[model samples]
Target: MSENGAALLDEVEAFHRRFNVFPLEAAYVAVALWDAHAHLVDAFDSTPRIAFLSPEPGSGKSRALEVMETLVPNRMMAANATANAMFRAVSATETRPTILFDEVDAIFGPLAGGDEQLRAFINAGHRRGASTWRCVGDGSSQTPTEFPSFCAVAMAGLGSLPDTILTRSVIVRMRRRAPNEVIEPWRKRLNEPEGHALRDRLAKWAASVREQVDGAFPEMPEGVSDRPADVWEPLLAVADAAGGHWPARARVACVELVKAAKQSDKASIGIKLLTDLRLIFNGAERMPTAHILVSLNSLDDSPWADIGGKPLDARALAKRLGEYVTADNDPIKARNIKTGDGVVKGYYASDLHDAWTRYCPPLPESPLLPLPPLPRRSDPVDR
Candidate 1:
C-alpha cells in the first residue's frame, strides 16, 4: 500500500479503537462505505445509494447512523422530509452534507400515495451533481429555487423498503441476533468518553486527507450495468483516496451490495408461481375461477411448488402475495374466491400480478456463495 493509504487505514483503526466500536461491526461498516465509494466510480448502470434494514425494530439502525455521523464529515437529513425541504437541505451551499434518511419506508409507505414528489427527488439524486428547481410558497407568481443532488444517502428501515427505492439502493439486510451473538446495552454515560475520543481522531483523519480522499478513484469494474456505473463512480474515487486494503475491499463491496439491491431468486416458489401463472394465462388465453384453482393446484408436480418447506395453498398464497401487490385493506376480488367446481374461495390473479411487479422485480447476480450444483450418483456397477 502507498504511504498515504497506509496512514489512512491507521487513522481509521485508531478512530475505531477510540470509539470502542466492535471490530467486526466497524469493519463491516467501513467495507460497506468503501464499497459504496467504489461503485460511485463505476456504477454507471447502478443507483448510487445504500439502504440499511433489520427484521425488527431497535436493531441499532439509529445507533449505526450515529456512529457514522461521527466518522464521515457529512450532514444528516431526515428521510421523512417533504420534497421541497429535502431539496433545500441538499442544495444549501453552507454544507455539502451526506444525507441520512431514517425510517425511509415509513415515510414512503407500501402504496406511497403521497410520496411521488419524494420519488422524483430520489430518482434525480441518483445522478451525481444533478440539480432541480422548485417553486417556494403558495404565491401565484412565486420565485423558483434550484437545489443540487445529495452527495451521499443512507436510508434505514424495518424489513424491505418500497420496491422502487429498493431497486436503486445497495441493501444492507441486518441479521437478527444469532444465539451466540449478544450485544450489551449501550450505556451512553459509560461509553460517551470513548466514543468521543474516537470521533476526534476520525475528524482529524478527515482533515488530514480531505484532498486525497476526495479525489482518488479506481477504474470501473466489469459487469456493471449502465445505471449502477454512473451512481457508484465517485464513491469508488473516495475509497481510492482512503487507500490501504480499501481499493480491493471496495470492489468486493460494490459487487455484493449491488447484488443485494437487485437480487432475484429463480428457485423461489413465489417467483415460480408468478412466472407459471403468467405462462398459464399466455397459453390458455383466459380462465375462470375453477380453472385458476386447478391450474394453481397442478403446480405441485412442477418445480414451482412449496415455500419454507410447506406447500403453498391458494388462501395462504393469496395472503402472502397480498402483502406485496394489493393496496386495499380488503381486496375486491378476494371476496369472491371459488373452487375448481365453482366452489367459493377468496383468491384472485389480478392481485397477484400487482404484487409481483412491486414486490419481486428481477434478481441481480447470483450470490458469491451460490448453492452447489446438483451431485451425480455413481452407478452400482462402477462402485
Candidate 2:
C-alpha cells in the first residue's frame, strides 16, 4: 500500500470515529470510503445502496446520512422526491450525484401508497445499464425517454425496507447510544471544511485508482455469496485500493453484517421457522403439535414467543407451516395417531426432513441446545 493510501484510510477511520455508529469500526470506515468513491460507481456493474435502519426513532440514522452528505460527490440531500424528479435528476448530469434519502419509510412503508415507480427506480439503479422509460412532451408530441438509474444512494429510516431494496443494500442496523458512549457533536459550520478537505483528498485518490478499482475483484470472505457479494463488491474494492488494515477489516465487516441481515430479514421468517422445527424434531420419528409448540415457545431467542402479537399457538403454527405444504405433495403432514391416551394429530420426521432441505438454511452439525426445561407447576393445595 502507498503511504498516501494508508494515511487516507487512517483519516477515514478518524472521520468515522467522530460518530457514535452502532456497527463495528470497520463498517463505519468502509462506508466513509464508499462515500469518497461514490463517483466511480458507474465504472462498476453494481452500486450498492447504504441503508441505515432502526426499529424506532432517535437511533442516529438521519445523522449518519447527514455526515455522508458532507463527503460524497455532488451530494443531493432529499427528504422526499417524486420518482420522475429523481429519474430526471440522475439523468440530467453526466457526473451523477450521491443521493441521501432521509425518512425513507415515509416513501416506502406499508402505509405509503402507490410508490411502485420509485421503488422500481431504486431497485434498477443498483446495476449499471438499467433504465426506466417514461413518456415525455405534449400529448400530441409525446416520446419515450429512457432515464439512467445508476448512482450511489443512502437511505435512513425507521423499520426495515422492502426485501428488493434491502437485498441491494449494505444494511447498517443502528441503535441508540449507551450512556457511556461519546462522540464529537456534528455541526455543519464547524465540520464542513474538514469534511470537504477529506472529500477532495478522496476524489484525488479515486481519480488515480479508477482503472485499478474498475478491474478489481477482492476475494469474498467465506459465507458471503450471491446478492450479498454483489452489494459488498464495490466497498471491498475500495478497501483493496486503500490498503493497510482495510482489506482484513472489510472482510470481517462483510461476514458479520451479512449474517446479521440474514437473521433479521423478515422475508426469511419461513426459513427461520423451518430451521427451528428441524432442531425441535431432532432424531424423533414423529412429534405431536402440542410438543412442538412447547419446544418452540421455550426457545429463548426464537421469534415464536411473540410472533404477530401473540405466542405461537397451534393454529398459527399450522397456518404458517401450511404455506409450505400443499395437496400435491405434503412436506409437513398432520395425521391422527393413536397414543396411550387417544388419537391425536402429529407430524412425521420424514415429512419435516423434506421441508428442512427445501426451505431452511443449513443447520450446524449439533442441534441448538435444547430449550431449558419448563418450570414445573406446583400441585394444587386442598385449600
Candidate 3:
C-alpha cells in the first residue's frame, strides 16, 4: 500500500466515473481496478470474467466495455468474432490479452445454433493453464493442437449468459441512465489520451507490486464463498496492495454484488425455476405434474409460456425440473404421487423444501404475535 498505488487507484476510479453510470459506485471502482489488475492475470490461479448485462438495449453496456478496453493492457475488442476467429485470436497471443466481447448474447443465446465449443472455451478459460484441443491440418496429417484459453475476459450484452459463465464472472447489471445522471461523452479525440495515461500508470504500478500480488491472499468478506471467493480473490488482492480506501471498497463491492446475484439468480434457469416453483407451491404438501404445468403457465408473467417459443408442457417441465430433482447429487428430489385416477409423477413438499430454502429469497418475517381479531364490522356495514 504505497502512496503511489493509492493515488493510482483514485485516478482509475475517477477515470471510470467519467464515462459510465454504474448502479453502485463501488462496482464502477471495482471494474476500473480490475482493468488495472488485468496485467497480473497470469499471477493468479483464476481470472474473473467481468460480465455487463442489461435487460434491454441502450443501457451503456457496450460503452462500459469500450471504456474497459481503453484501460486494460493488451486489450482486443471482438464484437463480431466467429467461434473459430475468437479461438484463433486467443491462440495468436502467447501472453494472453484482455479480450472484450460486446453483444455476446449472439454467441450464447437460445438462437446461437450450438456454439458449444466456444462456450466450453470461455468456461475453461476462467482458470489458469486451461486449454482447448482441436485437430489441425488435413485428414492424413491431422494432429491435435492445444490452444491456451486463459485470459482476462469481459462480455457485455442484453440479459444473462449461461450459468457456467456467470458463476465464473463478476456480474454487473447495467441500466439505461436516467436524465439526471450525467457523464462525460466518450470521444476518442478527447478521452483517448487521458485513458492511455491512466492505463500506463496502472501497468507501472502493477509491475512494481507484481510479486506481492502474485502470492497475496486477502481475506474475503463474510457470505462470499467458493466460486465467488475464487473470482474476487485477485480483485481483493489488488485492492489490498493498492492501499487507500480500495481494500474496504472492494470488500463492500464483493458482498453487495454477490448478494444481489444470489437473490436474483438471473443467469441460472434451474435456480430461477426453483424460486418460481416455491411461489407456486404456496406451502402445498404435494403437487401433480399436470397441476404444476397449469399453474406455471397460468402465471401471466412467467417465462414458462415463452420457454422455447411454446408453453411449457409436461415433458418440458419434467425435463427442466429433472435436472434439480433426478440428479443423484441434487438435494431436491421429485417423487411419485398415487392418486384415485392413477399413479402420477409429482413433487412432494418435503422434497422441494430444501431447494426452496436454499435458492429462494427468504419469506418476509411474520409478526411475533398475531394482533387481536378486528371487532365485528356488521354494524359499520349497516350504517
Instruction: Give the Cα lDDT of each candidate.
Output: 0.56, 0.81, 0.82
lDDT of 2 at 47: 92
> How close is every model to the real structure, measured as TM-score?
0.61, 0.79, 0.90
In terms of lDDT, model 3 sits at 0.82
- Please give the TM-score that candidate 3 achieves against the real structure: 0.90
Q: Encode model 3's per-residue lDDT on 1-383: one tens digit a residue.
A: 53388788888788888898898866876797688779788778989999999889999999898888878888888776766766677786565678899999887767776468778878998888888788889978999988888888999988789889989998889999999999999998889888888888888888888998997789999978899999999999999888888889889988888877786646677877777788888888899988988888888866887887898887776677666642335645456899999898888877777666765678879836888667686635433
Candidate achieving the largest TM-score: 3
Q: What are the clashing pairs of model 2?
A: none
> Which regions in candidate 1 have their CA more than 4 angstroms from the true location?
1-47, 77-79, 111-114, 184-217, 264-383
Looking at model 2, residue 361 earns an lDDT score of 72
Model 1 / residue 277 / CA error / Å: 4.6
Off by over 4 Å in 2: 1-3, 265-267, 276-355, 368-383
Across 100-219, the per-residue lDDT of candidate 1 in tens digits comes to: 778876765443454777777777776655777877667697778678864566777775655556556655666555555555555567654555554455455445555654444458
List clash counts for every candidate, in order: 39, 0, 0
Comparing 1 with 2 on TM-score, the higher-scoring candidate is: 2
RMSD of 2: 6.1
